[model samples]
Target: METANSTHTGSHAIKRQGPQQSHNHPLRKDFFDSLSYWLDSPSLAYSSWLSEQKLKDSTKTVYMAMFGRFCQWLNEQGRRLDQLEADDIRRFLDSANPNLPQSRKARTNSGRQRQQYVRQLEKVFAHLSSLGHSGTNPGRIAGYERIGTGSDKPTRFLNREETQRVIQLIQTELDELRQEEKSTDEWLKYRDIAMIGVMIGGGLKVSHIRRLTLNCMDMVEERIDLSQPGHAHRARLLAFAVPAVKAWLSVQEQMHGRKLEPTQKIFEADRSSGFGRNSKTVTLSASSIHRRTQRFLAMAGITGERASAQTLRNTYAGLLIDGGATDDHLVDYLGLQASVTAQRLRNAYARSQLRPAGGAHLSKDH
Candidate 1:
C-alpha cells in the first residue's frame, strides 16, 4: 500500500495534518502580498496597530483583503500606499458604495463590518507610523458621526421569559445528553451543555468563554477573567469570582474532557456549520455573539423583547435586583462597567422599592 514513506520518505507514519487543522494559521498565502503590506508603507494608523493587539483575525482578513483591493485601485490611479495624504484617504472614505464587490469580494458583512473596516484603515496607518513608514493616519477624516447602517433598530436583548427558557433548555439538554451515553470525548454534548449553562446562567459573555486559552481560566482559584480590548479607564475585567461565582465545577469537568489546555479554546465556534468561515474558531467572535444568543433564544422558544446574549446578562442583573442583591454587589459579581451600571443610584432606587409597599413616603398616623 502507499504510505508517507512511499510518498516522500522512508517512514510510513501518517501526519495529523488535514483540511481543518491548517486553516487558521495567521501567516497567509500572500503574506508578502500588495494588500496587507504596502511596499512603501504597511499599516500606519496608530490605532490600527493598537487594534492589532486585540483585533480579531476574521476582521483582519476582511481588512487585509479590502486593503489589497484598495491598493490595487491606488496603483491603477498611479498612486502608492506610502504616498497617500490625508486627502487621499478622505477620498476613499467618501467613495462608499453599499454594493461594494466581494474576494475581489468576500461575503459582504454589513453594519459593524463597515464600521470596523474604517477602524482597520486607521490602524494600518498606525502600524505604518510605528514602523516610521507613513506620514499621517487618515482614519479620522470624519468626526464621530455614526456610520449609515440603513437602520435604527434597537439592539436586541432577551426578556424575562426567554431568560428562564434558556436556563430550562440548557438543563434539559444536559440531562438528556448525559443519560443517552452519547457524551464521549468525541461526542462533546455535555461539554456543550455545561458551556451554555455557565454562559446563560451567570450572564457571562460567551466570547469571554470561547477566547479562553488555558491561561485565561483559573480552575483552582475558581475564577475566569477576560479583559475587553481598550486602553481606557472603562475597560472591564469580566471577572467571575468566589461567594458569587459565574462558572461552575461542572463546566470545569467539561473543559477537561474537551482536552482544552489552559491556552486552548474553552468555548469553540461551530465552524462546521455556517456559524464560522474558518477553523481556529473556538468560540463566537465579539461581533457574532449577539446573533448566537438569538439562536439560543429561538431554541428556547422565547422570542419577544429583542433577545440577545447581552439581554441574558441584563436578566442576570435583573435577577440580582429581584433577589435583593445590592447593585454594588451585582456590579462586582458580574464584572460590569461603571458607566453601564450606576451602583449607587440603582441600589438606592431598588432600596426605595423595598419601603413598606406604600404610596406615601411620610406617615401621618403612628
Candidate 2:
C-alpha cells in the first residue's frame, strides 16, 4: 500500500502504507501485455495515471498500439521475447511502411512516426533489461535521430471560433433531437452536450475526463478532485476543482432530472447497468471518443477544422492564451500531455493576436 500526502496541487509520496503488493495481483492480470510494463512492475491504475500524465488519448493509444503490434509481430517471427533487440526495432524503422489498403487512414509522416515509435521502444527496451527480461537493450534507436532527424513533428490545437463551432454543432444536434425525440432515452443529448461543455470549458483532454470516477467530485465545493496522473511535482494535485466546470455539470444533472451520485461517471454513453462496465456492459474505447468528436465537428460544419476531442480542448487553450492566459496556466489548465506541447499553441495564440489586420495602409501621399 502507498500512503500519499495530498497537497493542493499534487499528491506527495509520504510513506509506504504497507508491504508492496506483487504485480501478479489478479486485478492487474495480463496487464504486462502493454510494453510499458516490461519496464516496470504492472499496475491496472498505471493506465489511468498515464492517461492523466499524458493528457491525450490518441497519444496514449498510438504508442501502446504501436508497441503491441511489434510484440505480436515478434511472436510470429519465431523470436523469443527475450531475444528481441534494438536491431529488430531499427529494421522496422528502416523499412517502416503502412499497409497499402490502410494508407487511407495513414497520418502524415507515416515513416517518421514509425521511427519515432522506435524511441519509445528504446525506453521500453532499457526497462526490460532492468526487469531481467533481456540481457541487452539491442532495440534502441540510433543517436542521430533524437535531435530532430526531420521526422519528428508536433501536434496541433484549435482556435476559439473552431471551438465554438464544435460546441455549436453539438448543441444543434441536441436541439434537433429535442425537436423530434430522437429516442425515448433523452439522456444521450444531455450527456454528450454536458460532456463536451465540461471538456471545452475546462480545456480537458478526453482521457482526463474519461477516467473520471463518481467519488472524485464534490458538487458542493463546485470542484472535482483528480487523484492521479501527476505531471512533474507541482502539477499533481490532491484535487483539481474548477467551480465554473461544476456549474456545467450541475446543469447536466438537473436536466437528467436526478441527482448524480459520486460513484457515477459524469459522462456515460450508457447511464444504466449501474454505471459500471461489467461482464455485460459494453466498454467504450478511445476510438469511439474520436469518432464521436468527428460526428460532432461535422454536424457543426467544422469537419474540416480537425478530427479530435483535444482540438476543442486546444481551442480553449488558444482562445484563452491568445486572450492573455499565461503559458503556465495553459499548460496545467489543459492538462498538457508534454512539457513542450503548449509552445505551438502559444505560438498560434500569439500569431492570431499579433497578426496585423490587413496591414496599416496609410501612404505618405495620402
lDDT of 1 by residue, 1-366 (tens): 111111222111111111122233455344332233454444332223444356687766666666655665566557655545333443344344434554233333355655565566666655444444423344432212122232222222344455567767776665565566443343344444444554545546443454454454444534344433221111121222221122233444353454544445555555356522444344544445444555666787754444445445554555656656554455454654453343543444344344443221221100
lDDT of 2 by residue, 1-366 (tens): 111223354332121122223454335334443434442333332343345444477888766566555655665556544444333444444343344257553443354665566566555555444434423333332322121134422233444455556656555655676577544355555556655655555554454455464565545543345533453212211112233234345544654455655555555555465543351123334445556666766776665425556456555665555456555655555544353656756665455444443222111100
* Alpha-carbon lDDT, every model: 0.44, 0.46
Angstrom error at residue 327, model 1: 3.1
Q: Number of the top candidate by TM-score? A: 2
| Cα RMSD of predicted structure 1 | 17.4
Off by over 4 Å in 1: 1-157, 185-188, 215-223, 227-260, 269-291, 343-366
Compare the candidates by lDDT and give the number of the best one.
Answer: 2
